[model samples]
Target: MAKPQVRYVCQSCGSIQSKWMGQCPDCQGWNTLEQEASQAATPFANKHNLRGGGRRIELASLSSEIEPAPRRPTGMTEFDRVLGGGLVPGCAVLIGGDPGIGKSTILLQAAARIADNGGSVVYISGEEAVDQVRLRADRLGVAQSPVQLGAGTAVRDILTTLESQPAPTLLVIDSIQTLYSDQLEAAPGTVSQVRAASHELIRYAKTSGASLVLVGHVTKDGQIAGPRVLEHMVDTVLYFEGERSHAFRILRAVKNRFGGTDEIGVFEMQEKGLAEVTNPSALFLTDRDRPVAGSVVFAGVEGTRPVLVEMQALVVRVPSGATPRRAVVGWDSSRLSMVLAVLEARCGLAFSGHEVYLNVAGGLRIGEPAADMAVAAALVSALLDRPMPNDLVAYGEIALSGEIRPVSQSAARLKEAAKLGFTRAFVPPRGNSGREIATVEFPTLAALVDHLTDGL
Candidate 1:
């Protein structure tokens, strides 16, 4: 038998190397390469025939009829919303978040709710003790819930115990990084171990018709720590995001095989547990008794839900020979720079000798391009020190040629704004905005600037 060959794998990018190096060649991450053992191929195995001996898979026709997957709703409405209605049997979910971001708390609450509803639930914690989980349950007022709890890090032992009994309706593995497989010599949380453990857990969920939810820890870059393949193996990938200084947490679905992506569920972290926020628009919108400069209401859509958030900007005149600073929060900084450039070149507004600051109120990040017009309005408002109408909302896409482009779901955005007592909307031309609110159409970025400067 040939001895096992030693290899170094980059934890950041999962690239394998012949030997260790100071920095990973693929990802340029310093000190991220770890030594791993790989079995060498034998001469007989290498020379094996390539003739197929396996069974072929059956192909299905595109016209074939299929029933929708059955869903089991956890009592938590926000959690169920993120899961595309509810949890589907045999569905594998991967939820990743930062440290102390309430990933475990939300899962535990869901587990308790399922158990209380007469569904079987098994929560296996790899990082915490059973007593600690019990203490948390008590704190959350769920101590009486009959949730089967266990603490283990060995994947084989956990599977063996799970297989001995009937399959549970919900199976939760808290922190997949801590689980290790005895078949691999690599340490837990390494690339090999996480991949192997996750594969085993996902396979078990598939065969046993149980829903699997895996909690994952994130890296400093806010990405799930482990091999990237782990995300592809799961049915749905959820990200729990929120700032530490804020009480609001946003659960967003980045990828979902069963439902639409970009769906978000809002939750508020409380002393007891995570509470669902039904009116998320209220949480993201600030109370404004009077019109304020640099503050604009943005009618945005998150997944299928229309959200109204406050866009705040600040522009300060800088002295000569000093570099102008551009600061942004909860919005893309590059996009901010692009919008500034367009305002300068296309709209004839100068921001060269000014420091610009942009923030999306309530710590909610806005990604859609529909926010471009709202951001531009805020910047121009701040620079000119002109307060916009308190009940006005803005949303549209800005083009490089200064033309204001129409966005999708304009009616939906308008309806949401109208529901929030907004009477006027600043939108692109030729868009169908509902009659509930009055809309002022802008043909170009210059038109918007004119409306803000002269019309307002």
Candidate 2:
């Protein structure tokens, strides 16, 4: 028999080393190496077949008629929105977020809803005791729902207890990092343990035809805490994001096998729990009837949903000795700088001695470049102290050559803006996209600047 040896492993990048070191060579993280059992073959000799020992699998044709996968609705519209309608049977979902981001709270409420809808659900928490989860359920007013709860960290024990019963409709594992397999000598939350436990849990879901949801802790960089392969092993990966001080939360889907990616679910936290915000566009726009300088409504699209959000800008003169500052809230700071430079070089609008600040109203983050024209409008409006018409909306991409470019889904943007009672829209020059509102096209950045400052 061969004896097991120990080796050092980098927890940050999942790199294995022959010996321990103060710093990891792969990720350059200090003091992140941990000792684990080595899988080297010594004198151990267990002979088996050199090849072929599994059952033959049957193949199916693409044209064959097949029943579609059934969806289990948890009765939460916002939750279902992100999952692309509802949860599919045998789907494995990985939800990651920062500490105290309400990941656990939302999952508990979901499990209770599923149970109330006549579906059997099991919630196994490795991080909290059964009583603790029950207390939270009671606080959320869902204690009456018949959801089977268990608290354990041993993967073997968990699988064993689940073997004697029928397959549940839904299974939740609170934190896969806390689960440790007896097959591996490594401690819980290590890379090897997380990978092995997730594999087993996902396999169970596949074989039993039950929906599985796994909660994951995030690293300081906001990524899930595990080997990158852990994310690849799941069918869906969701991220819960928001500022801790804010009441609104955004549940975004980065990867989904059964649905579209980049889809988002908006929720508001309150004393009752998380409530769904059905009309996110209306929630993001504030006092749209009253015109204000440096504030313009941007018709933007988040995934498949069209959203109208206010873009606010401020430009002020700084002292000769003080450096001008460029502060941003929810939009990219570099994009703002580019807009400022274009206004200066292309439209002759001086911003060198002026401090600039930009913010996207509501807690939502804007990533699309289609916001460039709206941002430019806000900057011009602010610098000239000219309030834009309350009935107008704008969206287009700007280039360094001072040209306005057409954005995708222009029709949707215009439709959303008009639905919000806006009568005018500024879009890039393109073939007429049929719209319900009055469209004012901008051929270049200079042209829009002329319109803003001509009579300021």
Q: Point to the candidate with the largest TM-score.
A: 1
lDDT of 1 at 66: 94
Q: What are the clashing pairs of model 2?
A: none
- In the order shown, the candidates' Cα RMSDs to the true structure are 10.6, 10.7
What 10-residue stretch in candidate 1 is worst by lDDT?
Answer: 45-54
Q: Which regions of candidate 1 fall more than 4 Å away from where they truly are?
A: 1-51
User: Largest lDDT belongs to which candidate?
Assistant: 1
Q: Give the alpha carbon lDDT tens digit for every residue of 38-127 in model 1.
A: 867666655673555567889999999999999999999988888899999999999999899999999999999999999999999999
Question: What tens digits encode model 2's per-residue C-alpha lDDT throughout 1-456?
Answer: 577778999988998998999999999999999999975554332234334456778998899998867788888988898898889999999999999989999999999999999999999999999899989999999999999999999999989978879999999999999999999999999999999999999999999999999999999999999899999999999999887878888999999998888899999888878888998888888876678999999999888988899999999999988899999999999999999999999999999999999998887899999999999999999999999998888999999999999999988888888787888888899824746798888899999999887853
Over all chains combined, what TM-score does candidate 1 have? 0.89
Q: Which regions of candidate 2 deviate over 4 angstroms? A: 1-67, 431-435
Model 2 global lDDT (CA atoms, 0 to 1):
0.91
